[model samples]
Target chain A: MRISWITEDKHTPSVVEYGKVSGEYSEKARGEHTSYQYFLYSSGKIHHVKIGPLHPATTYFYRCGRSGPEFSFKTPPSQFPLQFVVLGDLGQTEWTASTLKHVNSSDYDVFLLPGDLSYADTHQPLWDSFGRLVEPYASQRPWMVTEGNHEIESFPTSYPDSFIAFNARWPMPFQQSGSTSNLYYSFEVSGAHILMLGSYTDFHAQSDQYKWLQADLANVDRTTTPWLIALLHAPWYNTNTAHQGEGEAMRLAMEKLLYDARVDLVFAGHVHAYERFTRIYDNKADSCGPMYITIGDGGNREGLALTFQSPASPLSLYREPSFGHGRLRIENETHAQWSWHRNNDSDAFEADNVWIHSLRSSKECWNHTQDSSLDVHDEF
Target chain B: MRISWITEDKHTPSVVEYGKVSGEYSEKARGEHTSYQYFLYSSGKIHHVKIGPLHPATTYFYRCGRSGPEFSFKTPPSQFPLQFVVLGDLGQTEWTASTLKHVNSSDYDVFLLPGDLSYADTHQPLWDSFGRLVEPYASQRPWMVTEGNHEIESFPTSYPDSFIAFNARWPMPFQQSGSTSNLYYSFEVSGAHILMLGSYTDFHAQSDQYKWLQADLANVDRTTTPWLIALLHAPWYNTNTAHQGEGEAMRLAMEKLLYDARVDLVFAGHVHAYERFTRIYDNKADSCGPMYITIGDGGNREGLALTFQSPASPLSLYREPSFGHGRLRIENETHAQWSWHRNNDSDAFEADNVWIHSLRSSKECWNHTQDSSLDVHDEF
Candidate 1:
């Protein structure tokens, strides 16, 4: 696992000393530090330390620098019965703290965020604040994230590059999954293959994202990785008035690919609301299609998007504008449970819950072998 | 394998379609593109396409971009009988072409270059020329390299960062080996574990490079990877008068770790001459010490270091001022052949040839197990 943090002093070495026991670090690893340019925001060096070849489902205690305080983390299991907490649009706000508190109460394996992490926008120093805000939980488990609209901190002539801060601070293992850009990448954990796609980046037919997605989907082996899930910022099947039609172009360019791959779940977060849809493809219900859901309720300063269009379609099973987080518990190879919790409720209110079956085991989808897709790409 | 190239047009998709046969690209992959900063020199786009999970010891025919020419490369084998060509200080000169021609005549699995690649030296356009000049050889085989003094294209204030072009163009699998910086990394190929150390980077006991090297060396399982080799610029042991004492500090900080690990050989450059040393540690001959060799005679624009200090030490086995390359042919697990070839020789002149026995098989040194080092780090 890779552990990254920042320090004011560049002379301090980037090192992580870790072991299986608390306060007793047996293993040490070192990483490189890089600094980026931000207008009206100059700061210290950012340290990234990658330590690995670790055991699955193991807890490790670590210290960042020589004199820094110690921290601990548990590696994700290699088998089923794994739980992943999904939080989105998580800005540094009071509600975000509540959401985190609610999340911390549960024992989960991984943290997945669609995007809009810091909500810092162009204020680069807030990135440091955001890092500190989530360091407690983020240091304990792997937090996989993607880019959102707000992450595009592009300026006129001074700072033309977008996502410079986001990319630098939140570097992903895109290269491991054959992704050229950290904006979009995939990871397989606990018999599940989760794809973090870049909604803000290019998604045209000839775009690098589209081509990579095609190749990545074609390369999945459903037999081993039974659960196929995807996450992006903009919801393709959102009914909320906020950010409507934002994902239309992306859906038009890549919906067929997902549908054909029989991806079990497609989670998105851009609407700042919660909405669940039936197994749908191209705005219509399809038996083999993915269960699309938008859970952008993790609290940010921008408040709740409480307005939904009147007369929701039949495909829209549930829709709500509330501050909450979701969890996907993969119980076994065939069955999994997905539930969302509202933060305001005194009790853990499971406002929406559903049982999902793996599309790999479904007779309707299992027959569509990966070879057919491979053949299309002329890949062996 | 990752294939990178430049396109004159930004619209051109960075795609590599590949297969096992000629003109039959069955598998297709897409990569990301980026534009970098140069004073006055500007290019369209640099595309880096990574296509992998490929079978080892197999031939792969690939085409980069949409309309680029077809190229082929053979992946290094997983077993013994692997050959690695060692060339250093290889600038784009006629001597470099001659050295390349001499190298191309024989087949090698991997190319180990210890820095000073293009010698563009801040004239960024020369980077393009160097890339084009070596494309035929580089595209066919993996050219693993590190940074050199010449690679530091740092200008006082305008371009303060060093190795911007080198880092962008020649991205290595440093992360794969748990390395945070591309400047230093280790890769296990065939039956050998090769460490590419950065000579220009910080190498103090408290530096990240030192910590990383310690951890990396301790993690190596000599039982699996029997042959342990290392490469770096600035020869630790040199009799050449051109660049003396350049590698003294680095050698002081790192020599003990390599010695304790029983490294079989260490290849270095930067002296602009060919010099080979006997098994030596500290300043004396040790049975378990690495046989350090300087092969900086890779035909750089800077002429050869014609002068060798009089009264050569007994440790310095061979020294010569000529443009040539060296090859290490690991014939088997227990034996290997090291030979240097002179560029002007009509025949493949094995000017300096020696047979090396694996240190792992030596009863004198192999007894110092990895556990002893791991115990020091408290690693499991």
Candidate 2:
């Protein structure tokens, strides 16, 4: 097997020394970077390496280059009950420290961030700085992520095409899961299947992402991984007023596919608030509908969105405007717990908690009738 | 092409999004780390991705994961006259800061560090901290390195094998050059070829390294890269009382090959002081001898080696007891300038300067008679 790392200098060769332990190492991987920019990495090419035949649930020690302390990481177990931490719209702010501290102590096995990561907004230096900021936690866990509006940073004439920094650094496992677009992909952890969808990209019926999503959902083998959870940036059912109906069109376009595919949960952010809906299907509560949770308040510079739609809709169960994150504890194939926390300037407290249990068997869920035939209601 | 970064966490997938300026972006290489330790990357798999045929001398913007600011690095210019800063025995001391600052502002192309990086000895945690310490300059430039005593950290039965941290972190281009040992390797930059040797490894005639060195020197096509320089850990011709003859045996075993190959310069450390040697072979001055320089004064926790071999030899041109680093500015095919800076607290000043010029053509120099017939004098 081999190892890897990133160098500010694009020309710097990327190498990683890895083995079973700290000293007794075996292989080295020397990989190359895709591109570079002068704002930070004078030699801006991202260097990488390929290595493997690795065993799951193993611990190994390695470093990026000749320097750095002996960094160590543990591989995931090839089985189920993966503990994951979910976050979104995270920015570096005085409030972020608390959310991060809470996360560090939460005993998470993996991390899922649905975009708006550094919020560099085209400020290249911020992107570099953000890496070090999260290096403590991100470097330790398998932090899976998707793009958000903030990640669509672009500069006039200089970077007019957008997501330059976003797509350049966060290379997800999209290709391995059958999607060429960095916007969407699928992976498995224990018995749960996670689909990271793209809200910033084209979601219309004619788009490639839509077709990929259909195939990805169609390919899921629920018996092996009973849980089907989808994550994206914009919430399909947010009660907050900030981005009240910002994603309404996106929802209308893809909601039926996810609903028909028997997606058990949908996690999203971008409203700068925390909102949880009780299995909503077209603005109404339906047991078969996906449990929708919006956890956008990961302590960003843009204070929390405190305003909600006047006289909250019946579909809304709980909503909080504060800086914090969410956590998912998958206890088994059919039972999982999710909690939304609000950071009172770093003193985080759980604002809401729920046990989401799948009602039908893996095969039975996917075989259920579509929302177009069985679900239609204006209120819970 | 794609961009990437090293997260302390292995399970954390590697992702780099980059584009020309800030917005115009395209590719993404989502990779995962190979191995992780139970410590930092409890998810012990170093994440990595492969991207590129990046344009030379172009800058691109990227972020490691969804977080971090947009960091940019420039690809090296396709052609040379590359200026590289050289440093050795650098550790995490207050004095190291000054040395690094001086080297950073020196405006060099690549960084050459010949071991004793963190001075962590066996304290592994220091290795990780040192990465951040040198990240500012290292990430900006390709900091090339070799093994030193500090990196030879080994444990009892658990890690009876030494350099565990070294090999795991710094995977040199040894394999590329036909050297199976990470302790030795060779690479080319612009018009210069660098040979990084290991002082801690076995260098006897029958050793793999010796054979590799013989083959490497024999294969150098100096016509393309007219500059040939070798660097190692222990100094063979140091005037300092500290480690005065630490590498004497190594010199006796390998000096003839280097001298015969017309390796213009030999750099080393392990003597906590700086000393510049006039062209010497077997303790005697010779016009064709490689200019040997010992720059082990890059401050570490171990204070400077103030004592010297009293009544210094005539072959020694200059010597200084201080903490600092060096710089090499290759002007053309035959001439290059070298300078050493002392970190006077933070205000750095040049301690010595010299212009080293290779007198004969690459082939002509190598054709010179062996040192044994060149009238070796111990009492020179």
DockQ of each: 0.01, 0.01
**Model 1 chain A lowest lDDT segment of ten:** A152-161
lDDT string, candidate 1, A52-103, tens digits: 8899999999998776888889999999899999988999899999999889
Query: What global local distance difference test value does model 2 have?
Result: 0.73
lDDT tens string, model 2, A1-380?
22334566544657766777787568676665676452222325554555566687777776665556676666666676677789998888767777898888657777899878997654465677677688777666678899987786532222346577777777777888999888788888778889999887788887888888877776767678788899998788877756545567678888987887678899998878888889877777777779999989888775678888879888888988878888888888778888876665343466788988863454445456333224322111
Clashing pairs in 1: A26-B378, A378-B26
Model 2 lDDT per residue over B264-325, tens place = 89999877888899998888988778999988888886668787777988999999898888
The reply for model 2, stretches above 4 Å from the true place, is A1-5, A38-43, A345-349, A359-366, A369-380, B1-380
Residues B274-298, model 1: lDDT tens digits: 9999999999999899999999999
lDDT of each: 0.86, 0.73
